[model samples]
Target: MSPRKSVADTRRTRERIIDRSVAIASVDGLEGLTIGRLATDLGMSKAGVLGHFGTKEALQLAALDGASAIFMRLVWEPAADAAPGLTRLTAVLEAWNRYLETERGAFPGGCLFTTAAVEFDARTGAVRDAVARLYRFWRRRLVAELRIAVARGELPATADPEQLAYELIGAYLALNQAIQLERDSAAPDRTRRAVARLLAAG
Candidate 1:
């Protein structure tokens, strides 16, 4: 018989399950994720999987949260740590590229939230609301960083932080989708160049 798990071991096991769920969602879309498939893939019993999450919706929400946590660690935190201003602005963009390339395998379909947002934008309720919140938060952070850059004289005073932020985000989103469909590494590099040009123009 298997030994009983300690508290830390249980937590670790749960995290591994969530990580697997995020990977599955990235490739399959959130709707395609299921406890049975997750259990089969992870070699855990359905009861073990269901023990971690009581329902499909619960698992979806947990996956969304897990994806968000990774995004913060890989993209947001690094950018936020840079000097507030042009340095931070560039750091943010660079962090995103790094996440796409270096952390490629983490999200099989690319950006989980990006895919989920488009999938559930009009669906409404907790899941949709959570996605919407994450999107708004990211955009606001970008704008804030750009504003700092302008204030510090790294960007032109005339630059509209909100517009620039939107453009940058739109470009990244487009590139991410293209990369997923075409399986091209150049897509992310193109995004990097576009961001650099935008920053240089500011």
Candidate 2:
């Protein structure tokens, strides 16, 4: 094969590895991601899997990156073009409300960031830092939108954007847990109510 063909093949193989890794890590927790398991799942040799990423940690990080892309595609990007402030924020939360339930093909185990947050929360090092960074970036996005809504009088002038962002994230996390654990059919409706109440709060 030409060098160009070889490069294309290499990229395809790496993507396959990351894709399978994200699926496995989403369900089993990042700690449960093993080279042997990936090899078996992908019909790859353990060496082949390890060759793409020098270490298991590297593979984990790659999976995290892959999952993040999926999330932006499914959740954030759809609402991205909505008018800024309350309109955009409302659009995002609505997309989020559906994402966990609807995007089973991309994420069979619910939100990868939610799983990663729990898996790495009490730990230190790169994985933990990566999880925290994603959460921080998302929180910042929510807070910025909330601030705009407040300034526009869409929300009360006394509204606290930082606190509203915190509550919004908390409610969504609870929504994920409810659907995963209880298979609660009303969880989405409950989340919507919570969002409305939180937004109307002074």
Candidate 3:
């Protein structure tokens, strides 16, 4: 009943809502998120859910943030300790593949960003902006390592960091489609081959 305990409880409850919202949005897309559904799923009232987020847009944005945090923890943090350049880049890419292949429990329908990018690719507003920002953040992370590889002579002097980043992105896009859309058992192997070629060329 203390003021501090009440505030802490409120924060915890808000995080709980965001956590569930992220999981739902990963499968259904952010626009499909509804306070009513979330409330029912969480056993809270619609008013309570809406009160925490204030608006549907606000809730969607919060869910995007939650998904982003989950992604960073799962994908990037695992490779964080590797040495910079090819070693770290390989670790990061391998971590990413493993995250996509094994982290289906958190994202049952594949990558959250992949789904959101398709859904919001044609839309405009804060939600779309957030999605774009996350994409840029991820690509920049990859490109930074690519640049380090170049500096270390792991890659050719003429290698294009941005182009390499694009190729790696395409590999994952194909992996997502192959696994989720085609249900291809060989998709992971295909992706690893593509990644090997992409890096092997540089």
Model 2's lDDT to the true fold?
0.91
Error of 1 at 146 (Å): 0.8
List model 1 lDDT by residue over 76-149, tens digit each: 78767678888887887888887876676779778998889888998988888888988999999889888988
Q: What residue pairs are clashing in model 2?
A: none
Off by over 4 Å in 3: none
TM-score of each: 0.91, 0.97, 0.97
**Model 3 TM-score on a 0 to 1 scale:** 0.97
The residue pairs found clashing in candidate 1 are: none
Best-first order by lDDT: 3, 2, 1
TM-score rank order: 3, 2, 1
After superposition, candidate 1 runs with Cα above 4 Å error: 1-5
